[model samples]
Target: MKFGYRIIFIVSVVIFFLNCAYYYPFFSDDSLISLRYTQRFIEGKGLNWNDGHPVEGYSNLFWILCTAILGKSGLDLIWAARILGLACSVGTIAVILNCFRKLHVKKEYVFFATLLFVTTPCISVWAIGGLEQPLYGFLLTLVLTEVLYIITSKSFRRIYLLSVWLGLLALTRPDGFLFTIITAGFLLFTYRQTKTNLLTITLAVVCIPTLFLLSQLAFRYTYYGELVPNTALVKVKITFHHILHGAFYTLSSFLGTFVLSFLGLYSLFILVIRKKDLFGFYLLLNIAAWISYITLVGGDIFPAYRHYYVVLIFFIFSIILGLKLNLPNWVHNKLQAGIAILIVINVFLQYNIPQNHRAVEERWEFKGMNLGSTLKNTFPDKTLIAVTAAGCIPYASELPTVDMMGLNDYYIPRHPPANFGTGILAHELGDADYVMTRNPDIVIFDVGNTPSFYIGEQLKKNKTFTKNFIKVTASDRDADYILFFNTYGNSTGIKRTDSELTIPGYLFRNNEDNAVLFTKKKLLKKMSINNRYEIILNDIPSKNWKIKNVLGKNLEVDTEIYQKNGQLTIIMIPKKELLLESLVLEGKD
Candidate 1:
């Protein structure tokens, strides 16, 4: 009877996961970036965004490689990945349940908690999103299961297995190091009870992961010349604003995904401090650590909270752990049943609440797939492209793109943004100057399926931009209406400009009569502090010119230079009917 019940419970959870996956079947824009990497690898171009250029665009190195393996075998990319990820997602429930069974959690309670976990929108979406999160979550649960075995029983073989599992966890995601560190705490806390010795402990906790990490680091550093992935510098701005956003993200995730959004954190407290349950403590500690890390980096901006998928799973596990420790276990069982019932009700009652509505309205999910198909069919390989979105455009088009928002580009993430005050995320900021320098053949602005970027608007203000890049009026197969600009020299073999164009800073105001320059060269301003600038004004300016004087509201040849952080806005107001001529910008000896 017990065996039959276990099989039915597992089957039911699997069924629930499949239904949710099919109901909200959409691939994330971010996942396409990895798919592109996998494609490049299989095509013998290596694991890079382009054939020659090797940039570690993705942080999920192991998964990228795994997908490449599947692609290499001549299987359909999306279906194969979905099949594999679904298996891993289903495996997560079984592993977690087995741990609970071993920990002596009640069978009914285990079934209920596991059901709620598998059905949660956050878990269901990523489980079938064709990303590595499902596999990452699976590896994480396996590590947790092995740790549980170590705490409950003592064996050298189990110790070795725990080390291997933890190492695999780290390989799945770099942040898995936190889990290994916290598990060391669990090991030492119960060292005497479990009879784990010093040598074994040292090797398992520190040595195994260290060896794996070192090999990866050595290769990555030698290849990319950077220790961390290129994406890290672009993201993870640990500022006050980012921390606040992280805190807000945590609350919103809990509230949005479950019937009672705040209960997960509260239950974690009850399980750890009140019940004194060691397993609960482990889960809570890991959750706290992961949340702190995510908060420091700023919670992920993607819908469905994809970044916190692993943490959410652990969080649900922690909540279940607390439920296992409740007074008069039947009352706790009733509460669990109620929570699960609420989730089922919301899935149907509020079908569009979690993320389905926005995803449908914005076509957020299909943007990448659509753009990818268009690019692969329309553009040839080696076409130099630039786009606000780094993922879909490069992946779909197979174009060696200058990632304007800097996910794959090396220079964009390392430099300060050209203009600000409007972008959605700091890490997604684009360098207009750098993009202009790269001179891509096709520059897609807010158009296409990805979110539109204001950086394109910022670039439009540049004079060289208007001269060299012309806007295309036609729309692509995708309904993205954002502007698309083609570089001047795309068709013409000859360079349009007579002389090389180099400006000290951004050209904010560039017109026929008067031009204004916002110079970021603060050092020049500081040096010119005592020295007066030779302000030459045109003798005649157009009637549209508001100012007839170039200096201090009066027409003068000399003007004093004042430095504000070495930046100066040079506004040239010419004399009536006269245009600024023979522009000379040279430093004195």
Candidate 2:
């Protein structure tokens, strides 16, 4: 293929990955929290600091940059952040392609290397998500690419460019400091023979990232009280055992998520076996150091692969260089074919599978309820509604909601305030003329447990004090629980009730050893057991109770139970060895 077509192909692959990113929801928790912070910052709130102390738990530079470009409100901010990530991803790919071209590597090698970096599941997935990893990876790769140029051309301009990229990289992720250290070491060691070039690269490299870190530290001290954030301290306290576990996890993650990551390493191994040169040695050392750093950080291993993808790209470039200079045509062709097949499979999986749709699924399940519509349709527009689920409520309902979560530190005043649970709930409920508690309102307790007497007592007190209280939805099926609206207060005229019951589900568990149980909660009293009746118990049922089917943990049963003298009993003997928690009597109205 022509060099121009290869370049176009690379660019197309990058764009295709960026396009694929749109289908996945913003799955990163840190990204979501950062978005919330960005919204707050744009509203004039300062950086997060604890108790008037300067601490750096999080740096909102990327989010600020995103909000500045995307504007506040709507889902546009997510797209904008993703676009910025895509730009970095595309730039990283371009750097790799250019480096291969400059190195006089074979076109096939360049294409394979570029394909490895672009289509690797780990890199591609994160390139589209709103996170700093892809951007960090890109900047790191660009710095390395610039280093390659500086070494080849000995240009003062390349040195300066390297310094700028290093600075931006540090600003992107704190780990960029390692890149600065390693690069400085490499320059000093190699170019000691040329003092001028050595000093220029060393000074520029040291000052760039150092200045960024110091400025961030200053900001931290001013706002949060410490050089490093409390969050970092908390993370750093894990045991060495956890670190080892994390390393293994990181390895498994590479295998599972980025299938080509291991393949790229295998290709590097092949290159090393063929030609063990200084470049190959450096590639191995870089990979080892990068992997060590990731394992030491003990971060989410899968995500860390995404964060350090630039290192993978660097390795790919080295492999291409090695292959072109040493490997035979037959060997190179076979490797290229294997890599192409891997890329095709990865791309197919990316398109066909909804791997990252969990975020959207959560949002739809939890946030799609029309709080405002539910309220306006049932009550007056002016009626005040207090909700414990504050974030979703405000977005879904047009009416003002007292956020029990204390998000943004908004709460109603109270004297001799209640505990964290009731105090917050009271703060929300006190000013409200109406209260809406969705399924499992108590939060700590579900329908299986008896309702809290204190809650009912408090409601009774409030009702007596105000001489006005009415439960709108009281039936078990009406709403799982009741919504209280004031009959005498300002909310007197408004009335609303939801007939639909959001069925609360519970996971089945078996406390018995070596047994599995599966059952739903709140089963009916009288039920006919037929072949379709599946009973999953911790222990196997008695021989008397025929097991029609034994499929994995589930046991299908066919039995008859008839009420006798106001008592219900099954004819089959209860298994003495079978331990039971609670029986779920199903199929009864």
Candidate 3:
């Protein structure tokens, strides 16, 4: 419980060990998108994804910019990013300890909660996953610390500093703006309590954030030519389904992993039931802002639950703050034991979960390494390359690329597919026609993938696409060797599974069946005018298969030994023989 360097070192060591525990360490693929931007900046490419266009493809700008600056020194970027993530996460623990001491919480209680936080594997998850979560966590916890100071002691300087932190938080993640606004509003409204004037208090609270926001807007308009980051548009559907996913994302990521999440939620409810104070009310406002923001964005796509990381960190600190002021002695004794048991169970789960496998779920980040190399070797000319997921491939390859779903594109995100709703992820589907019109030499559908991105689906069917690009994997003759991760076999040859057939642009697969799927209703209109659309078959049908409409209505099908110029015809050969390979739709467009 003592605030000593030894305790700090112990907590720090525990953090590092637990972070490296679940499995052999691996960074996230999404993190690489920002790294790609950093590398571009390092290369003097003027911070653009493409040569001339400066699009804000990434959400974590300050992190990318920070690393980009470090990248200029030819630093070991992998180590740098990971190390920074660790530092920020560790810093959150230290700040928590300090805040508890400042609020006069029992030293033992502070140490206990802080220990639980340090050992929580989810804390370590982001520590090594290589993203802005740790930094965001640190900034937010620090805000809570200042929020405590502002509410308890009425420090003038802390109020302004809180504004600066709030601004920096927003700049770090796009959704952070919600926190900034809510905090600023709380401070202004509570001016009477602070014993400061509205004018003085407003300046104290809003000055730093206002300037930071203005500077951000000016730079965005001048460089990226957009007021909002491109990712803001890319990851948005904002439907009721999104709210449902948001709830699932938080529960599954936080409560599913960190046992303390239940404690944190319960603590909030208890606080609401008990007497309300300035600090408690402020915490509630911030929590509401953040939760709504997360719901609006449709939750995180990355594993290990990133979106709520900082919120949980802040929430835990606030819980400690409230408990210090109010819990009974008997309740305190029980919580102590409860936390100890939770810590053990939490560690056990961290060690046993599917996350430890490092293959099926955690393999994406490791794949980025070889995938990037393969992309580079495949596209030796450094021409235009399009990818659904842009981070890992573009970052590792260090090549000129297009973010097809529009995170980095100027056009595609603005014009998404007709009916784009994945309901889980929140990115816009790229315009298939536009990507084709741009004519990327090698288009990839890995990054930011979704059903709507089936503009990617339609792209493969487009005559121009099939004519220009070929389905080339990283292990293809067109690419270099790809060493799979530990569990995967040593050989680079990966056989295509049945699931591979469903992938949009896979090679040596059924082009027609997987290409442009037309249901019975659309099929009628899809037929060319005044002629039967006769698709060449590779073989005959073995079973009865009829075209179905989008609404699942079966259509009346009629066929014959249809033949075009010189193609072989087998419609009349026999029944119970071959698999269906083609279709003959007789109708007018």
Clashing residue pair totals per candidate (backbone < 3 A): 9, 8, 5
Expressed as tens digits, the lDDT of each residue in 373-457 for candidate 1 is 5655544465577776666666666767787777887887777554322235444467677787877766675334222465566
Better of 1 and 2 by TM-score: 1
Question: Which lDDT tens digits does candidate 3 get at residues 502-544?
Answer: 1111121222321222222121111111223232332222223
lDDT (C-alpha) at residue 268 in model 3: 67
Model 1's TM-score against the true structure: 0.77
**TM-score against truth, every candidate:** 0.77, 0.60, 0.76
The ten-residue window of minimal lDDT in model 2 covers: 499-508
Q: State the weakest 10-residue window (summed lDDT) of model 3.
A: 484-493
Error of 2 at 226 (Å): 1.8
> How high is the lDDT of residue 311 in model 2?
56
Candidate 3 Cα lDDT to native = 0.60
Please provide, for model 2 over 1-589, each residue's C-alpha lDDT reduced to its tens digit, 9 standing for 90 to 100. 4457366465657555755554455444345434544544555655431113222434445445555456455545556667776777777777777776777767777776666555555565666656776678777777777776765676668687888777777677666677787777777776778878777866788777688778877876676555655434323434465567557656654654454565557666765676554445556666777777767656352332454565566667665665676677668547746756877876665444333333334332122133334444443444455443433333333343433222222122221223322221112222222222211121211111222333333434443322333232222222332243332233322111221111111112112211212223221111122211212222222222322221221223333545434333333222222322223333222
lDDT of candidate 2? 0.48
Residue 535 displacement in candidate 2 (angstroms): 39
Candidate 3 lDDT at 257 equals 54
